[model samples]
Target: MEESNFTEKDISTVETSILSSVEASTVIIISVTWFDTRLQSIQWFGEMIMLIFITGLSIGENKVADKGKC
Candidate 1:
């Protein structure tokens, strides 16, 4: 069995990827919901939640980058 060795750079890469993916997904979701009036009632709530999550991810990514861990 081989053991996986993960470094801070690797972790930073993963976090960055996740942050980008989530940001993109949130944009797509908002755009999709924008054109569909039927889902308007829940759109704001969903987008708010996604924005909060994206914010947290951005904060974490920024901290990692600032700390020179990547």
Candidate 2:
């Protein structure tokens, strides 16, 4: 098996991708909440935001692992 090596630039790219995904998710969540009347938008937004944060943290941890820093 061939092992691929990633440079610092690769790690930065991953971080940027994760952040962009989070931003996209936020926009989707907002649009959904705005379109729903019965649903509690605040609660949904908060939960989704928390999920996004957790996902970002996990991605960051993975990046650290890839860098052999943890």
Candidate 3:
């Protein structure tokens, strides 16, 4: 087995990027729900938006993880 060589700076950078992405996603989800509620006719649209965002987030995190392994 080989030892990993991740530095503190590298970890910090990855953490910051992840946190920022999550924070922005949360804000967008909230905004979309708020608007959907107001529209009334498109109330179900909020759920679809939430699903799309969650899927995108997962794919993005995977790519980030892959990059970190290099």
lDDT per prediction? 0.69, 0.70, 0.65
**Regions of candidate 1 where Cα sits further than 4 Å from its true position:** 1-38
Q: Write the per-residue lDDT of candidate 2 for residues 1-70, one digit (tens) a residue.
A: 9777954544566566667767866776677688653547786687678677768777777878899964
Q: Write the per-residue lDDT of candidate 3 for residues 1-70, one digit (tens) a residue.
A: 9877965554454456556666766776687677653435455466467557666766787898899999
Q: What shift in Å separates residue 32 of candidate 1 from its native position after superposition?
A: 6.7
Model 3, C-alpha of 10: deviation from truth (Å): 17
> lDDT: which is higher, 1 or 3?
1
Model 3 residue runs over 4 Å out of place are: 1-41
Worst 10 residues of 3 by lDDT: 35-44
What's the number of clashes in each of the models?
Answer: 0, 0, 0
Candidate achieving the largest lDDT: 2
TM-score list, all predictions: 0.45, 0.42, 0.42
Whole-model alpha-carbon lDDT for candidate 1: 0.69
lDDT of 2: 0.70
